[model samples]
Target: MHQVIASPQGDKFIIARPGTRKGMQIPRAMHHELSSAVANGRDVPGWLVNAGREAWGLELSGQPARGNVLVRPVTPLNYSRATWEINKGCNFNCEHCYLAERAFEGLPRDEKDRLLSMLRDAGVLWLQFTGGEPTIDRDFPHSYRQAFILGMLVEILTNGSRLHRPEIIELLSAMPPHKVTVSLYGASPESFDSLTRKPGAFKLLTKGLKAAKEANVPLELALIVTKHNAHEVQAMREIADEYATTYTEYANISPTYDGNPQPLAAQAPGFLDKSSVFKGCPAGHTFFHVDPHGFATMCKVGRENPIGLMTEGLDGLLRLPAIADAQMLRSGGCSGCQLSATCRVCRPLAKAYQEAKAPLNTYCQHDNGDETA
Candidate 1:
């Protein structure tokens, strides 16, 4: 079975399995015990077993657990990759956006520079610049340039509407990101604009993509499958094929960051049918998201508990108790559910449903109305 174990000191976690050569990094505080147990490949310590149960919902039989525990483990002292949302303000109001019309003031130029410097100091090797729209941020080029100069591989996630601007193309052509992901909403302008509620957005996105292609920036196309544009998914795929860019698709539409299910209506019918069993999330582990306000959370799906970057710094914030606490799964009837084999629902969304008894139809693979679970 595929599984992972939490760090003994409670900062990082690792995927532990038999026949694998990786395990948790020896915590300085519990070096002897952890090191011995990990080396023997005999048994996991009681605290680690209990932490696995509590933090990750791991069902450990009363036996000596042995195997490669840490698969691509993260060093508690630093993270090599990060997803930074430079600005929360977005021009489009896509119906299925996880962020509910995100709007926020951006960090000043000096503050952005400081954050960029801190990221480089923390040993970030790849920085993904994202936003409501990253290119829309006036301070983006400065930060992107700085990250590139620091020798970090930079990437951008945008809707491709702003790439058509001459200045935008010039900046990108000068120092292209490692990759540019343009989310395609619809195959046609009418369908795309109807879904985005922004007239001429599809045209702008196409023009921007053409410009980016001419500039020779590595590009990718992602399709957001929704009820409004589900029919256009294949057409969008064909468009991406024509562009010779990497193509991907996501049918699931999650609740907003605020736990509001307003965008749930746009979810395509039978989207959950394709989901497989719940494995685990990488939150508080190898990956984390930093919002516009410098608050770090596991991911953008749920922003329930956040650590302030200014106060804690990336290392300190990630090590904070809240980061691990957020990973803890509420029982909420999922522990012994019969559908665990094909259940794709995650703990964060389940927690939201548990607290409010809200119905999240998007994750209901079996179509039952029991919201308490």
Candidate 2:
């Protein structure tokens, strides 16, 4: 319930409000002083009070830092960011969804509490709750509130179908998220409903979007361009502009996370943007992903050697970095490939394409007869 969070993000000390994008980097001395004041149940230092007021317009003049500002403790774990799939149960059936199956199931409430605590103990400062659609999850409100209570900045990735619900709007208004990223299927009701294979889907999404906008909830729109809705891209951008919300267009569709090629059929021709050259990433080393059941993976695209958080707890994560390294090895069909240096796909993603037996031209430069490394 603290108004702001003060935490160590890697080597940097930052003070950030939960709902706002603005954050201030403070000196280590200032962080320590604030921590001391909060621990001792003393008033917030005058400088922080002034800084909060100036940076976020917060009125924390004489408030106890203990209740006004949460000082997140540095943990043994080095992770600073994570994404959790609250549940894979989405209300819409998008053809290009990456999950092979949309199972509407997750850990019970008690286990979810344990998992969130473990995430907090693991040093996760920024947590994104995604799903097949996170808004519809029965425990979403509780889990979202719990994450806030645990002093983690929370974001949500949704389809914007349920944002209009009174309880949801109320929960979000009361405890604002760092962001709510909604995926826009199409601009028109006919196109959107047809693409999602759900009648009236567009009406629900627009309703949710308007409600969220009116609530002043932070929002970002992802315009998902596929074969069914590729023609509506301009209109979708107009919608985003209408709301004055930040937007990004995603046209490159990939196979399901489990290597099913069904989603590839939805890829819009001439709209599949070429990915940039594969560079190294800090998946398990810095940030990781979690499934609804608390199984931690290196990232969403690479699901190998998942560590069961429900069983092994935080110690299970110790194995992730090594596992991530092994998964990144250029083995299998990619072994001895000279073009890997300039290849657009990473090892795990390449492995997925290989598993799906997809056409080489979709992911490999070698398929185009380019031998340069």
Candidate 3:
């Protein structure tokens, strides 16, 4: 089990325990004292208890409190789960991929090992291994095994092209990723291969799904809605249901992380007019995205401003003023706009702000027909 302590001043600490990851935030002055007590297994001082009670209604005791020494049901820094794009290169070039073609360039093996060590030490509880395609990386096995051995819940996001191979399934069954999610492009070979631009990829994907089911790998399926496959979304869901796997759908198509607009034109109908705004986005505050070159950003699409993971380390990167002050980026015109209620794009997903001072045309649609500046 892993325990995390987040200070009100934006510092995070990971403490080991039996089970459950606990998080708390206190003032900077009290952080050192509380962390010292946690590390030494000593009772929290009187001052610390008073501060905890006033600030966050924290309950603490020398004896076990509901199986944990310190009890904090929540914290501001919810930095437990993270998505690491180990490699950017994918075997197939899907038409609607958010990543550009250059995304296939991956970091050197040694750099990958170093980053894994940093994440483990930082108390990352769940690691989602994503990429242009993670299986395409040769060093993926080594990195996956390292995280698994560290007691971290490992997840893999793949297209399921290589999963049919006996050796691939064997490795998955042996170590066993916590979750294996495969992206479904289309229901049939024609629709699937047309989108992936890879001949016979649909057959390979289905074969991999079958192999995964036979090998007892925990499986899930997701449908990515594109103009090419919008009509077949229901058929794809039925296929997933037949496999007895969890299914989900996402209709929104994003511009490339590197600011390419090529895929923007391929978005399905109602993709843009479907404006919805999630009140709070946890990207920089609680979650972060790491690119192939060890660059850590608030989110995958917000790569314009990045913190170098290799040079600064996780702790240092998280403490930066830029990351700590994470909040939704809204325009003056958007404040009074009626469409704000249904705007689905978050700050990081708004490439307009990250690139040039422009409003996201896709997210500016208003049912009331009010013009936004």
Candidate 4:
């Protein structure tokens, strides 16, 4: 049996293992369903624990789950605004690399199709086509085109180095994503190459950003905050400040398990808070991540292959039992904490926190399962 904790504010249900983490972890639908059932005098004999069990459907280790490992699934809202890392590997090297592992490599075509279908079905509103460099994918054109054709908004996040390549530019020029996200590593050659490490990467990135502007396509800029360029945030913004589609992303340097950029920093402590309230990291529901190998996951972090191959189209993915279950698990990061307003949780870090069975690193500010407040 599980312990069900309800929020005093209203119908928010916090279902978790007796020893698991705390805070709101119930899906909005389930909470409403249960609340309505109670209000209507329906003989709902089962409590949230029952619903929790129904969703996970996993035979527990028989040992009680540690309270740190809470379960809060995704809801309709999260899936709608999910950020997808369609591609993993990158062309440029950043000092604070997060997605530099082997898994970042492109997935097989069939697998790619399945992942896209799932995202479409799950009602993912914005699809961010990213990678070591999303442009590196030989079939990126097809992938970008497919998302456009499906009515799912799409964006391509890249270093912009290859944007000038004839074939690459021709394709990007012809069919641009809803928005093109590029990193302004530096304002000049020194600052740029210092972070990217590549000799001419900084110039290429600038040229690419300009190219996107000239193409009349939308643009978004992502930066990894670090000692190298924290002071230059304002300067960097000046260059593409208008295109900062992301509300404001400032991530501390956290190294990827592998393939990270040079001059990596120690994982910092503290959680990047979010203003948005979510049942969980909207992986399976609000968003789906497809790796280069064709495997799909609810969250982009970790190698945990929750749902298998994408057998059906977008609709099919939405109906996936495991994905649904995961989405409902809980938002392990942004509930009831002081950081709730600005705390931006990282899925990969959250998953790593869960997998490593360690404390939240101060660098990424993840929960190490040990909470002070």
**TM-scores of the models, in the given order?**
0.74, 0.96, 0.74, 0.59
Question: Candidate 4: what lDDT?
Answer: 0.52
lDDT of 2 by residue, 1-373 (tens): 7999999888888999988999999988998998999889999899988998999889998899888888887788869999999999988988878897899999999899999999998989999999988888899999999999999999999888999999999999999999999889999988899879999999999999999999999999999998888888899999998763599988877788889888888877777566688798899999999999999999999999999999998999999999999999988788887777777777888888788887776556444655322
Output the number of the TM-score-best candidate.
2
Per-residue alpha-carbon lDDT of model 4 for 1-373, expressed as tens digits? 2233232112344442221222345556655664554455454334444545565453433323332122233334235434545566666666666664634555567666666665554545467776767787777877776665444556677777876667666665554455676766646677778777788887787767666566665667766555566556667767767544452455444445332423345322332332343334534644566556545565555445344444433444444436546444325543344643333444444444433333344323334433621
The deviation in Å at residue 137 for candidate 1 is: 0.9
Regions more than 4 Å wrong, model 2:
365-373
Candidate 3 regions exceeding 4 Å error are 1-78, 271-276, 324-327, 332-338, 352-365
- Error (Å) of candidate 1 at residue 257 is 1.9
**What is every candidate's alpha-carbon RMSD to the true fold?**
12.7, 1.7, 8.1, 16.2
Whole-model Cα lDDT per candidate?
0.68, 0.88, 0.67, 0.52
By TM-score, rank the candidates, best first: 2, 3, 1, 4
Better of 3 and 4 by lDDT: 3
- Model 3: per-residue Cα lDDT over 82-145, one tens digit each: 7899888888888878875546676788888888767666555568899988988888888887
Q: Write the per-residue lDDT of candidate 1 for residues 4-71, one digit (tens) a residue.
A: 43232235333332212234444554444545665677576676677567654565545454442322
Q: After superposition, how far is residue 242 of candidate 4 from its true place, in Å?
A: 6.6
For model 2, what is the C-alpha lDDT against the true structure?
0.88
Ranking by lDDT: 2, 1, 3, 4
